[model samples]
Target: PEDSSRAASVVICMNTDRIRGAPMAEAEPTRTPQVDSRAILEMDRLHVSVDGATIVQDVSFSLRPGERLALVGESGSGKTVTALSIMRLFDAAGMETRGEIRFEGKNVLTMGMPAIRALRGARVGMIFQEPMTALNPLKTIGAQIAEVLVRHEGLGGEALRRRVRELLEQVRLPEPLRVMRAMPHQLSGGQRQRAMIAMAIACNPTLLIADEPTTALDAGLRKTIMDLLVDLQQRLGMSLLLITHDLPVVRRYADRVLVMREGRIVESGRTDEIFARPGDGYTRTLLEARQVDSMVDAVDESAEERLSCRDLGVTVGKRRWIGRDTLTEIIRGIDLSLHAGQTVGVVGESGSGKTTLALALLRLMDGARGEIRLDGMRVDGLPEKRFRRYRRDLQVVFQDPFGALSPRMNIAQIVGEGLDVHEPGLSRGETRERIRAALTEVGLDPSVMSRYPHEFSGGQRQRIAIARALILKPKVLILDEPTSALDAAVQLQVLRLLRDLQQSHGLTYLLITHDLAVVRALAHRVLVMLDGEVIESGSTGTLLEQPTHDYTRQLIDSALMT
Candidate 1:
């Protein structure tokens, strides 16, 4: 192979010799060549429309054999449409597609349903963005992978079972047999993603289209997945169409990039060239978003007294489960404190009891066995009516801004809701003034007050959420993965705004997130949670830089990659 640039080349061979060994290795015969070093997916003047509105206009690109091409764009930017058009999977209702999609030198649009179906999984496979939605819930992970083999290769019985296990093992999943029998609900987020990857690669398709494959994964898991994708592409000799908006992923993984904005290709070039000297303004903006680094650096503002919890115990259900022998305790003996103007970041993976802790602090959960003190006032065991009075002091910014905000309400109404709930009969002028000020503080225009939630972009909507939280003038703000759903640029803006707000308003924050970059940038103190327990907790600088626990070290390493 003369072209080091053409294929996924590795420096050293991996240790695949120890897998089941002996008879298993002997039984597995070498498969036929799958990849062809020729142009696999080519689009020329591709135009698509929905409900008489043009979405993708005159888009042209080509995916060469063994080449990794990335389609970069924001939401509603026709990236998904282009990929769907190639697969002939676009909806017939109010949607129209035209122009040539030459896959293996054949026009896919002209092909019949049966012909396209034949080529779908056998010739090309797709790794969807959200594995949770892409994978079936009731089917076992193994059966899902085996479906591809059965459909395309016609493998059945023992041959199918062996191939399914081999595919799972190839993706580096643990206990392949067990995972095969387990439902999607039984696996973790990362494990589900690996299973999805295994299914995509089961048929050894010539072309693989991965759309935002790492969106739901953590930084460490993301790196592992990308490495796995590269390895699989190399071993299978498949052409990869990588679609994403993440610039760091582009810098580390993609060879060529096609930048899209408003359904148009704004710029197309090599990854290094695009990053170094972005010709388009949109490309530059995308790069700038990715480069939004740490903006929180000042003297320690952690107050000595603000809020505290002691001997905090919490359980969701009344009756003990696990055959009446084991009761699942979400939080047990959890002792924590937050000083005035201090930022405490709680880090953990999904279903690790991070959100449970947050909800308990707000007294949302009933029958919670705990002692929570706010400003020297005990509120944990207080009645709901009395706790509502103390709620003014505590504000929460949820993870999903879209879901948090009311679609029917305008910006001013959303921000003013807190004030209306707490202090009724307030003058409309006063309410407007407060709303405008909060919006201004979050880097949004006051003029957008009349706009509805749907009218604003995602970044703007998130700012509105922050403004809503800030409007309450709460002494302590609980940020539940506030920036997880936002893009890099929007996230930076929000973080910087929060820092400024905290300093100016004298606000203390309890930031709950899984992103270590955010923790390093904004957190003064760190709390690492795993399986409903604090594995490690200390000063942010010391804990992140010199993490003692293995989990903490892993989180730090994941953040530093690329």
Candidate 2:
């Protein structure tokens, strides 16, 4: 998995011309289309309901030919359901829809199943948020790309293969031959997403619906993918419909924006006007840029380090059944210092060894040839039995809370599991009280301690994970991609909570993420890693503004800043 993420960083950066494409604000067209007086896609007074619950009520919008319209909203705002209604995907899911969805002056809701199937890939194409799940796992990349071609264009054999490779080249993916032969699991996240885009645009659909297309990519790759979409839209002369929670992206690409909240469109206007002067309170709140106080000045340099590592190196190797196995160096000559009541941001694209460095510092691996010190004491070379006591002093919060927290375990058991091992002598009443305190500290309802992880939203589950880590009262926390999966509104909330907790408890944090905005808000110091080494390190304000390395500069420039 680490290798995959790393490969993404390496491949995308290796040939900027191939993946990044030309830096054109506008696309040049190859051909002109006859003007259509009617809107390309229009939804009037649309209503979407699942069972007896109304999710979307009276939503309306329209897209002109070759125009880009962005539907902006947080999670559970019915943005996705509205988009799905256009293609009549709700029918397969047993969801009810009402009102008119007119594409080319024909109602999509009144179409038969056979007609809808023909309309899907042939006339309307959609790029899902998560490509790994949307794509067929058992099929090769070529087969998935060719499926849409064969069904929609009626091509077969060499013609289909040729078209597939051309589409792959059109999306700017490197090495068409290698990519075609690879399975979904073999390719990286960016690669899978590019392949998905190729499949969607195979037939040159009239409308391209990109639902959070770059959600899983790092800042550089996000820019690349978005630019690629724009390039394709201009070349094909098709309208673009983008659905996302990323406000920066909306500002950068969308000609117009529709702000949605709780299944209703509260505001709609020109992109620049809406951003400059938002009429809706909710829109203003969504666009508000949070300012976080850095702890660098508050922290005393003379004080002992909370966590520090020196010459840390991690070599990954496989055990051989017959002879000596091969080994590869993952992390090399890594060194950093973290002080109490401060946050250090480790930033790089996927597969840059940021996670691997965190793993080494967490001491989650063995054969690490380096010195790891916690609270001015050595811990790396200690034996398992002797080092067991130090486990409570170090804790980590993972990226995906849904995956990190067990589905079968309730909130109380999940949070108090650490205490069961460290403080086994405590009474049940004390344990329950501690659990409640931990939950309350992270802004969760203490009464929900009996509920399971599945009962909460993405933001709520992340808070639960934070509670689980806080219950141990660790001096340092290693957060790996903590807010990348959350909505913009929810991400700010979590960052604020982390900041408040750090101020009150004097906790140290190692924030590992690809989000430059998050780094700006919370991190006092920043480390830019590439290919298993720290390329640059300095104060956050200084490093970000005056980056010395070209890679660091590229990272900052690629970020979708507000």
Candidate 3:
């Protein structure tokens, strides 16, 4: 009976592996070809489906050793899905993968569970797009990287710790030992991303798959990460599979490009060839979107100030057990003025206090010391209850549409919540009319009002967020990284929409973003922020073309490179 029970357990395990489409035995040893083959990875007629819905269809590609390949597409375009499929990282029960994913002559689809596990970190490493979500918050950086080394390389004790420090150093992280002890949240965005890269390459994988690796980073940091990737790839003699929507990145780094759209590869060719002479209309459109048109016209300096701030400063404190609260000032005393019918861009890298200034101007943050005037009315010193009257005229669109919009609420409820609070006297019919108008203005269909935020795409969700802000008919609208999360094409569309809206309604904008391209597209006047101070301020044309400050020059140069 005991023997039968053991046999039954073995059979169940085998069945589970088969259900996952994983091989029951270890992968066979590679058989050397007659001639030296250059292909390190190949995908032939690959298709992936999740819960009966196709996410990737008939994708085929190959990566030669030490070559860089870019997979370009918009959101929900199967770029990430295809990459994940190659890694076999999907849920086995819900995901169905077909066709071949050959890695060094071994078919990953038919590799045994142990073989796949062995290949993942040691031979094929993946750096996910968002480091914050990918890194385990509970673990220190050392522990995270150590686990990879211990599992794949069998390094332990002092040897494991030394390897962790070396990995951190390889990624160019400062104070490797201190960084090893620090938590993910304690590190900056760029630092966290470097840590992620360190973990991905802990075992010195032969192939690295970086998905939107520089998406959340600043322009300077973006260039740094890109350089690091190229450096590491060349140093390790590894092939790179880069999945991103940044066209400039594709041009600069990728040797070849595959343009995917709606789960299918629309075009594939050499990076230079495709860019120089795109075969598909969609590819051409994407390229055209990269050429930003100046959405801002001549600024009327004589116009009245719609929003003005003087000596604005914001500070916060961290409580400690043994001493007084540790105070940290985010924004220093800074003055800002936005003229009516104008867009004033406040650009900076991460932690440069652009968002802090916006929050202070909106009176959303506590411990803000400043004098704020909106249309010549003193609103900063007013109490919360008294400030209610000015709320309708002052609104904001946040950075992350996914985070900004309430998941539980439908589109109508989310957009109409501001109206319910600010204009309670309006009837239900009037509220519906206003919501419809707002949705239409943002280029979203009013029929989607009953749908939840998750049902919509990233671009659509952003439009919904814009509608929520615009429904209030605010004179001064604060846009904080409004189009940063969107793809290049969607970003251009949103910029165009904002321009049209501003022209029609004479809306004053306080645009806060790290994207200089966005500033060039929509902002009339630009203010470059560094360490909470306005380092440079001028018209977008002059500031971007011939930046006077050293820091401003660096920012512009980095942006142009990307």
Best by lDDT: 3
- Candidate 1's C-alpha runs over 4 A off are 1-37, 47-57, 73-81, 84-99, 104-207, 235-238, 272-293, 297-304, 313-326, 329-333, 348-352, 364-368, 401-458
Q: Per-residue lDDT of 42-81 in model 2, one digit per residue for the tens? A: 8999988767677899999888898888998877787877
**Model 3, 1-562: lDDT tens per residue?**
1121111111110001111111222222121122424688999999988688888899998888888889997877888778876767654458888899999999999988777766664577777765665677788988877776665557788977877787677666777987898887656556777788777655556788888787656787776667766765665466889998888878877878999998899999988899999999999988888888787888689998999989999887667889788677878878989999999999888768887788888898878998999999999989999998898899999876766788899999999999999899999999999999999999988999899986666789889999999998999999988887678988888999999999999999999888888898999999999988998999889998989999999888878877
Clashing pairs in 3: none
Question: Which residue runs of candidate 3 sit more than 4 Å off their true CA positions?
Answer: 1-38, 49-54, 90-97, 104-122, 131-204, 318-325, 383-389, 406-410, 423-433, 450-455
Candidate 1 positional error at 203, Å: 7.4
Best by TM-score: 3
CA error at residue 331 for candidate 3, angstroms: 2.4
Q: Distance from true position, residue 511, model 2, in Å? A: 0.9
Candidate 1: worst 10 consecutive residues by lDDT? 3-12
| Candidate 2 runs further than 4 Å off | 1-35, 49-54, 88-97, 103-121, 130-205, 290-297, 315-329, 363-369, 376-390, 401-435, 447-457, 560-562
* lDDT of each candidate versus the true structure: 0.75, 0.78, 0.79
Better of 1 and 3 by TM-score: 3
What is candidate 1's local distance difference test score? 0.75
